[model samples]
Target: MPLSLYLLAVAVFAMGTSEFMLAGLLPAIAPDLDVTVGAAGTLTSAFAIGLVVGAPLTAVLARALPGRWSLLGSLLLFTAAHAAGAVAPDLPVLLATRVVAALAYAGFLAVALTTAAALVPADRKGRALAVLLSGTTAATVAGVPAGAALGSALGWRAVFWAVAALCLPAALGILTGVPARRTPQDAAERPAVRAEFAQLRNPRLMAVMLLAALVNAATFAGFTYLAPVVTGTAGLEESWVPVVLVLFGAGSFTGVTAAGRLSDRHPGPVLATGGALLLLGWPALALLAHRPAALLALVFVQGALSFAVGSTLVTRVLYEAAAAPTLAGACATAALNLGAATGPLAAATTLDTPAGDLGPFWLSTLLALSALLLAAPLHPALRGTGRTDAPG
Candidate 1:
């Protein structure tokens, strides 16, 4: 991969850390801001709302700019938002900063995906996306835990400061490394607004986007509440939660890497198998929550399956929407964020019921099964040519 792609990864790692580290910091934040844990949890939804609203808007606004400039501008805004968050004195201010940061996060990711695809040959787009997305996995593994520890030691505000500091190097890397011009072919191939809108009318592309949303919803529904589940239901100490998270992140990194290689030639099978694993994994997790050994093993497996499906789903959308790859990339970001926002809100509702913490697992299982059924018609064996948009 190119240095520019790796720089993109650096930027993504900063954003991903901001996105997920809030889960671990919510405990610290709630008390400081005089709010309930449930109220603090809404911060995650706020971030996702920014992503849903910002992706398409940024895609349109940045259409004329080179990828490098667009990415750099987004990072600058992201860093500024995090700086504001670090100093935020109240819940409302902090929540507002999160929305600002996430808007930049969404724009950066959409442009990065488009830029990654532009850098590689058509056949290698899946792998290129995998490389870019690996940064998120890396954040889950390293950044989240580190931020959690820092928050515990100093304060949650310190974590935001740390994220802000990291973005400086990432912005500098992009400025120095990425080219200012799109490749001539990519520039010429850029779609007009009409063509971009036309791609959304394709049923296959829409199905892929829906699948993307379902996959993210299933994963985040359970994942957003994992700390509570680990401490209360899984019978683990609070300290051990971070260790389990590291294992889950490791599995996600491995799964996405493997999926990237397979998705180029066998996206259908990869999606089908990943959905199946998730369907089985969630129920098993719910049933075995009391057994620490089983819970640990299942956490890793669930993370792997969820991310494998996610990577493959993005590849499928890009393929099906080849006429407007950049817009498709932005839509993919929006769809996944919509799921991210919805999943936690649904899980929050479940927590209000008698079912309690276990409710999220069941919710995840149902969503995973839905994704599997939707994927049924996408069998690789039935695909006559390798094209994603072919009629079933």
Candidate 2:
């Protein structure tokens, strides 16, 4: 709720926009870089892979850096990467720049969580994380669209330049407005981090994460192929792509806010409800793809459900891993990126068949259903795991 929290969102917005802008720009980039579209597509996976590798690595290495300084440093890296990406002369250089930027992306998120959690009360931690993360969700709506337009009108390079511009101000905000807090250099949060991992290793926690991962895999797998699905299955024109994305983004923005608010009140109900929405929404989305209006509606619902669950899941992780909150937060970001990469690969493989795009959606639906089942059982475990290690 603080202005500082929105400043955190500024960082997330730039990161999210830069990460996803490549998706819309791949068609243009392939020609400019003299590579195949498939080759250009590698940038998305490259960024996610970087995130997966960087999240924990940043956590461990940045252990000695102050959260504020670390965040500022990461933003600087992100800005430099975006600038290099904009001016990249070849495919290899572009890909490398993306990876470099992605490292900053992962580090920024990891430290941002650390910074955000330190600003709020223990019980309010979940809400605090949600507020910070809402920027990412909002990027789905605002940043992605903006990037897509820039890519369409100006050039792919222009999109990167635009993203770079965002970084300077966000850096300034963190440097000025975001109050500094000190944390241990050795990961004093390590014990709590271990405890949180132990909690995740718990059967209930494992089940919940598995469910989330699977559902996530499903949603992304189908989602990765959404444009083709819409074109082939729904008979929609390519021009309608932005419209569809806008619909989903709107849903994401709404869902992220609602989940954050609800989790702050009753995380259990919020998690359970969001999980259930995914279970039902995926099937509806899959079945409805052929009908443009129907598919649009399903996309909206699916976005909301997926993001709502996301908000609740992060909150739950923070609650359960209260002591090692930063590590927990970093792990969550890592897992989500892992899903982003894996889900699309799985969907790409499945959609390669003649069965068309709906198959991935159906698969995602099943995964989401499993997650829904796990949400209720693990809801209580999250509450129990909070603050067990705090000083008496």
Number of the top-ranking candidate, with lDDT as the measure = 1
Any runs in candidate 1 off by more than 4 Å, and if so which? 183-186, 378-392
Q: lDDT tens digits, residues 252-296, model 1?
A: 888899988887777767776677878999999989988999988
RMSD of each: 2.3, 3.5
lDDT of 2 by residue, 263-358 (tens): 655766666666776777777877778999899998888878787777666665555545555576676667677766666665555555666667
Q: Give the least accurate 10-residue stretch of model 2, judged by summed lDDT.
A: 383-392
lDDT of each: 0.83, 0.72
The Cα error of candidate 1 at residue 28, in Å, is 2.0
Against the true structure, candidate 1 reaches a TM-score of 0.95
**Global Cα lDDT for candidate 1:** 0.83
Model 2 CA deviation exceeding 4 Å by range = 30-40, 89-92, 180-208, 230-232, 373-379, 382-392
Residue 35 CA displacement from its true place in model 2, Å: 5.5
Error of 2 at 367 (Å): 2.7
